[model samples]
Target: MSRLATSVTAALVVAIVTSWTTVVGDARADTARTQPCTRYTAILAPGTWETHIDADPAVPVGMLRPLGDGLQWQFGRDITVLYAPYAASAFDQGLTYAESLSTLEATLHHMVATLCGSTRVVLAGYSQGADGIGDLATEIGNGAGPISADRVVGVGLLADPHRDPDTTLSLGNPQPGDGIAGARSQDFGALTERVRTLCADGDLYCSLNATASPFLSALGKVLSGDPAPIAYLIPAYTDPGTLIEQAVTVGAGWAATAANLPTILEGLDTLPRLLTSGDIAAAHQIASGLNAALSPMVQAAASVDLTLVASVIRAAAAVDPSGWTSAASVIADALAYVDIQRIAFTAGHIQETLWRTMESLTRNDHLQAAAELAVLTPSVFDLADATLGPLLTAVRGDLALAVDTLLDIGGPESIDELVQLARQGAALASFYGSNAHIDYAEDVQTLLGFLRTQVAS
Candidate 1:
């Protein structure tokens, strides 16, 4: 039967199920996606390759497919991003221990391969998706369960936690195993092999973890009757002619960085929530220690521009409220860490060098040490949950495959492309608005500033 035919049949079935079973909304809506589609899922057609990211519960209640680097209207073989069904059955009696998310991941991977031809799948997970590690659909969100996963080519997790389990790696914390202390990344294959935790200091106030201090700091300056230090810097804006080779190089699809930072900020906020309030002092100490441990990375990539260099620094500086003079400072510091890391990957000469450096952080004994640094000491890995968006996707190397095309479609110089990246980043943000119902318009607003800022020259 044709995919459309199957969709028709499935739609009819879903109609019936919704009428009788009451499995409406997001899960029910995504049922229409089961059609053997060529548009988006076909991108994952067995051999062709695509990313398998889980949509947040708040994502729009329908089949969502991002076209053209998620920047514009375009189509290709679609990759299936399975949604968690909301019917009580999914939790009450549907998903069992053996039916873990790993099983789901296995099934998705297997089906894509078996049906699609050994499709190279990148398992990109988000929020609870990351927290559950390898948990089944139902067990995610608010339970102690593991996601069943194996035999997938690549994996990415967002805003996930990798801190001392002894604190509260319980039902909601993103840590790995139950009844264990160091299992935060035990089941997280992606980070286990390559761990990079870029964090911001003061992310807890909003709970969504999507807050930024740089943007916030900018606002703080505006609020405090201070002028944008941009007066000192804006004059340096290079003319398009002069920046062609360099600005194009620097700004090329750099909008992805806008999308990347928020997720990391939110993920970093997991610590306070993870730490027992009883140990607020201990938790603060831990955050400081984690910051100190990762301080070398910024120094490692000093040759990069100020923006990149500063992002790395802000990762640690954004750890808490009282430590810094203000939120804007924290934003600058945290973003410095994150942007620095990505800039390394963006620089033609250093992309590979940076990726290897990032992956190396997770090798051998350094693996546990790093995860421990984030989890035990300060646990910047937690930033993976919300901000895992681009890094996790980039690390898997599929999105990286689209580098030239993404650059082409988004354009090396087109502000439209830049806007689209931010809009897509905003679209990514809308998921949080939907899931948790927070007025995170600022998430979109935050990206807008960077999107508008010309970092090229």
Candidate 2:
């Protein structure tokens, strides 16, 4: 089935399942509430787009609903399963992932404050929800959270964006790498023993190959409102003066590219007709104009290091609340959806195409020059049209494949090879948005059972 069909079908299934789960969960909550205070309270946070800010606490939904229901069923009066109500939204849905994270933190804090002193806590979250819970778990484990380390019995994270296989105990099939948002810098500290993470083999959210797409991983960190990844991702530019100089260089490059974009695009548009009409003189003139306009941009683009740009973004994210910080965050978030590798590839192709066209013109090879410039025209249009939007809307399948190719081959030898790799990578990246991430409730039954045992013991 097409990816879109699969996604639509999955959405339908989730909607149906969530609706039924709500009814079942409400019933379970009602029964559990009648019992006396339990020895342990299990706090659950659902994934992005799973629950609303004012969602009913008694009705757990999304991927964690089954886990919540199972805990209530197994323990009855021994455990209280509370589904945290937060703005479970993506960046476009009013509240950003960072805002939702704050909401989740506040909910956990309130739960910890009101719980009985003797009651222990178990935390569980899925996807973006897992991202927040993992961060909190790190804080508590490091002796800075709402509850003490000993007060927490078990922590379960499904498809956690901050998953670090090196630090946390992983269950189920082995994954390729740590979470796409990159791993938490600080280990779980005192709570490390109690925390367990589960990521399905193909789920990129929790198992993205950091080496292949360091920029994507870095972007993930920025989106999650974490700046620590920048330090690790770009360790070489620690000196302030050097970092500033690099940033200035990148800025100047982009500025020049932006300045010449209009002229380059115009030339690309007009050169084709000129070539097709046997206007050799006109075509050569246009090609020369394009080369001149594109030269500075191509040079700038070649020297543009995306890694450094990400670091600058990280520095911006770390700043105190201000217009600049907010703007940086917005820009970073928008960039998360952009197919940067594809853009880089296009930029490279434009330079190569322009070079060939110029060479053909010099040799009086009008036909060859026309053919080459034809290829250049579409690419220029595509680059010109590339805009900031959701990844799905902007690059769709290409983004994943481009990332995957970069991961597999280190770099493509030719555009054809890159295209082939992109096809394979799309399938790999599609797993992130697939049912694999959402169906973890069944996949993680073993972990849930372990949590029950841990709390009981």
Candidate 3:
């Protein structure tokens, strides 16, 4: 079955790439480049969506606009924006990710060929765009891409899905692995000094752990019935950065889930049963379907109870510890309890379930979490203790605060309080997950300092 799955995945990847390649062929010419060779500093912002363009300086879009505007204001030279049009669609991350890979590469190739001699390029991107820009940075750092390392001032990535914990690219908190899509072929071993990677706490795309991401990758494959997307996770698991990245991603995922209290509750309700079930694959499929139904914006957000799922799954497998020939099978069996047919993936169902689940998770003073923890098998508790016990304890206070705020907002309450809760949740998530990426003002200033030093040199 795995072999058949692999072959199917390969075929799907080839087809997706072939079709997207056709669309991207002509689009490469659209990689907007600035001219007149004025030695102006350049900021390339590949907006998360394909709609962003470089045509209007008056209109602000993406991370580059404000930063570029500031640089222009300070130096009196307009900053150039490199625009690459790629499908930054949601849910269909695999397709958009592939498009970004190709389009951004071509775009950078052109920019370097035309402007590198006279321009000092500073690259930045957000979300999917960040993934592409990070890849480009890796290539340049490795001396394998179009632009020479010296000609590039620095690179900044926001919520990069390709963030690798092992790379010196990120100066914030430490993680265990690379992005969900995986790490670059070559490490940014060369660009250590020039690269700055910022991944928000709980942004699962960049920070999901190496040990656990395969489950997510497999879950994605089983649910989506496509293999290409799973490809990223395979290589990603091997990257030393995968573990730490997964940790932070998990944190961010929990934060987002908390913000979408309704949606997370739905998953939380079903998670315990699936984790304890004898059939792991079925549990995984059900979990995947439930996850698929989650808001794409919060898809990476796994509820805080996810640690329980991990613990129970591992504990269940320990029963046949000697009987298991391979750990993969153990993991797969752990996911074998969920029935997709019984599950609902519709937006309406998700919304309804979100509200229902929120009520269940929070009512009785959020005793559900305590109940789940109490019922865990000793082995499972041990597993949780070894893995996420400390993390959960550390974040418990914030989680309580968030739950309280959420409950208050669920009633007829002030929008101000709700907004305040949102802010608190975001801050807590960052604290738990290493969302240092939010410090953009400081990051940009740091970048400006680097550019100044580089130009002076």
Candidate that would win on lDDT: 2
Global lDDT of each candidate:
0.29, 0.62, 0.46
How big is the positional error of residue 207 in model 3, measured in Å on the Cα after superposition? 3.3
Per-residue alpha-carbon lDDT of candidate 3 for residues 7-57, written as tens digits (9 for 90 to 100): 554466455445544545334434433335546555455544533322332
Sort all candidates by TM-score, best to worst. 2, 3, 1
Candidate 3: segments with Cα more than 4 A from true spot: 1-35, 50-59, 90-96, 169-177, 212-457
What does the lDDT read for residue 127 in candidate 3? 62
lDDT of 1: 0.29
Model 3 residue 337 CA deviation in Å: 8.5
TM-score, one value per model: 0.23, 0.56, 0.47
| 119 Cα displacement, candidate 2 (Å) | 1.1
Error of 1 at 7 (Å): 37
Comparing 1 and 2 on TM-score, the stronger one: 2
Worst lDDT run of 10 residues, candidate 2, spans 415-424
Q: Candidate 2: what lDDT?
A: 0.62
Give the best candidate by TM-score.
2
User: lDDT by residue for model 1 over 238-347, one digit each (tens)?
Assistant: 22112111211222123334333333244255444544342333444444443333333333334435463233223322332333222223333333335455433222
Candidate 1: worst-modelled 10 consecutive residues by lDDT? 42-51
- Angstrom error of the Cα, residue 3, model 1: value is 46
Give candidate 2's root-mean-square deviation (CA, Å): 14.0
